[model samples]
Target: MVLVYGHRGAMGYAPENTIPSFRLALEMGVDGVELDVHMTRDGEVVVIHDFTVDRTTNGHGYVKDLALSEVRRLRVKHGFGGKWGPVGVPTLEEVFREFGGRTRFKIEIKRGGDYYPGIERKVVDLIRRYGVNAQVVSFDFDAIRTVRELDPNIETGIIFIGRIRWFLDIARKLRVRWLHVSQDLVDPEGIEEAHRSGFLVGVWTVNDGEVARRLVSMGVDDITTNYPDIIIKAIRGA
Candidate 1:
């Protein structure tokens, strides 16, 4: 199967990274869920894409400064006509406990600029504990390196955007097997270059059928989307 991942747990369908979004993705049969995580002030790893909860929640402040209790108390914002529920910020451990073996993950660890040290180690431990390798994503090579050190078999993709060779060179040097790129920024040349070098190519935030079809024609292996239904439909010619 050409793997289809739910970007932020179907961001288009429900609040990003909430249980509702995750449930929708699983219902749609997505191969994996791509979520971003940040360390709270008290050291709990919470799942959220943005560095702060201000945009998505009815709260203000950087995510790193808030404790887990504060974050969980925050409510996720649902757009007009969308259902607003208390899909409180969930802990990575809680997410794993709920969906661990049942679903795959592409865990993106946010960089907090030294506000939190050893977070990479803790996040790596959670992935290791779940025993779901081939289930994490990050732009930080350090996170990937730490995860690799703990368990060399876990699949970790170094995320990059904009230029092709910019990431290709690093991937080659770091032994990164996957190049997770932004759908709009990636060109056929980039995909070809990565593929030629024996690396798997994946694109993110893709929701349109035409673009999805075009990328598949170009040999991209994964398509991460806020609309898993749309992507899966496009891929299956439904």
Candidate 2:
């Protein structure tokens, strides 16, 4: 059976990457929760999707620029019309403490504008400390490679947005267990190729039931979606 992962912790129900969002995902019975992490100025690992807080929170600055204390003061802007709420940005430590043992965590190391030096070490250390079933994933191949170098036992994956001819070749080089691809780019043929090469396939941000069923039929190992309940039902009914 395909595992259901809540994309940004049931982002459709609550603000992305907050405690309430993650709690809702667990309540909905998701097999795993996916979240993004960036290092704050205070050298703390905080969960938030974008490199900056302008999009998701009431504050207006880059996450790397702000200290965790400043970040904590901002409330998540939920839904349309910029509604303020109780949910704030959560630290990675807090996430691991609260829901580490409850579910699997797919932690994406955010590497957009400013690179967080030594982030892999910090993330891997936290995963080990929490003893949670977790995997570190990144669009940056070097970051994934760094994770492998730091600890070969820790599961690592590479995320890609579009097609790549050397996909499996690169994955083999990186020695990664998973290949996380965009839902639009995934196909049965590609899935088969990856599995044949001993790589598990995970498709991200899928929300449609029909699409979820199709991916399941194609033999995807993991389906990351905003609505895990919908996707779980679709897979079960299929």
Candidate 3:
């Protein structure tokens, strides 16, 4: 069966990256969960997709500009696929503790701007120290490289926002375990190269039934999306 990742953890059901979404994904029977990690001012590995809380949270400001305690104070938008609830933002450790060994975690580190410090090292160290290496990812080459340096055997993938030859070069040089590409950026030949290079290929944010089925037909190793029920069913020809 094609491995199905809950893109931001059933984002279609709950606010993405929040505990509600992640737990909900497991309930939905997804193969794994994907979320982003951003560092708060207090050196906490918080689960949030944006560099700031402006978009998803009721508060405003960069996550790096806020403390973990302060970030926790703000309420996340309704992620329950209906009305909002008491659900709130969750730290990476909280998530790990809650979902560890339950499902795979594909953590994408948000390393935008120069404000985030120690995030790359801390994220890698925490996952490894806690033995959750199969559960991490990042668009930041430095972050990915740092993880590889810390543990060469760590399973890591490089996420490309858009198609670029440099990503392939970096993946090759780093011996990354997989290549995560945005669905629109996919090219048949690029995926073939990745497969030939001995790496899994995962496409992200894929919600359309047609695209999901098409990618499955393309023999992708993994598919990350918001609607696991619809997409996974489509992948299975259900």
Candidate 4:
């Protein structure tokens, strides 16, 4: 069976990356949750999608410049538009503490203009401390490589916007076992080739029921989306 992961925790129903969102996704029977992480000014590992708080939160500032206290003060705005109550941005530690061992977590390490120097180590440390079933992934090849260096036991994957041939070589070099591709770039032949090369294929941000079923038919190992319930129903033929 293909695993269904809530893309930023059922983002279609709740604010992306907030605790409320994650809770909702878990309640909907998702196999896992995917979230992005960045380091705050004080070196705290915080969970929010963008490099800045402008898009998802009430406040406006670059996340790298803001302290954890500053980030916590901002309320996350609803993605699908409704007056949901204030939702504070969550720390990586808080998430692990709350949901650890309950489900799988796909933590994507995000970088803005430059890489977060020690962010990988901090993330790895948290995973070890909590003993959660988690994997660290990123668009930054160096970041995932750093993750591998920090802890070989912690699983890592590479995320790319479009199809790229060199990713397989990069994955092999980093000892990565998973390849996260954009939904449009996945197909049966590509998936088969990835499997032949010994990598699990996961596609992102799929919301259409028809597309979900087609990808399932194409043999995707994982399907990530903003609506876990919809994907679950599509996969189960409900």
**Top candidate when judged by TM-score against the true structure:** 4
Residue-by-residue lDDT tens digits, candidate 4, 37-61: 9998999999999999998889998
For model 1, residues 85-123, the per-residue Cα lDDT tens digits are 466788889888888788888888766325567777788
Q: What are the per-residue Cα lDDT tens digits for candidate 2 across 1-238?
A: 7999999999888788988889999998899999999999878999998988999888999988999999989988888344425778899999999987999999999872238877888998999898999999999888889889989999999999765335989999999999999998888888888888999999988999999888888899999999988988888862
RMSD of each: 1.8, 2.1, 2.1, 1.6
Kindly give the stretch of ten consecutive residues in candidate 4 with the minimal lDDT sum: 111-120
lDDT of predicted model 3: 0.80
lDDT of 3 by residue, 60-174 (tens): 9998889999998999876354464766889888888887778887888778325577777777667766676364577777777777777787688888887735477788887
| lDDT (C-alpha) at residue 55 in model 4 | 88
Error of 3 at 30 (Å): 1.0
Model 3 misplacement above 4 A:
79-84, 112-114, 164-166
Q: In model 1, what is the error at residue 110, expressed in angstroms? A: 1.6
lDDT, residue 54, model 3: 87
Which residue pairs collide, candidate 4? none
Q: Which stretches of model 1 miss by more than 4 angstroms?
A: 80-84
Q: Candidate 3, which ten residues in sequence have the lowest lDDT sum?
A: 78-87
Overall local distance difference test of candidate 4: 0.88
Q: What residue pairs are clashing in model 1?
A: 134-155
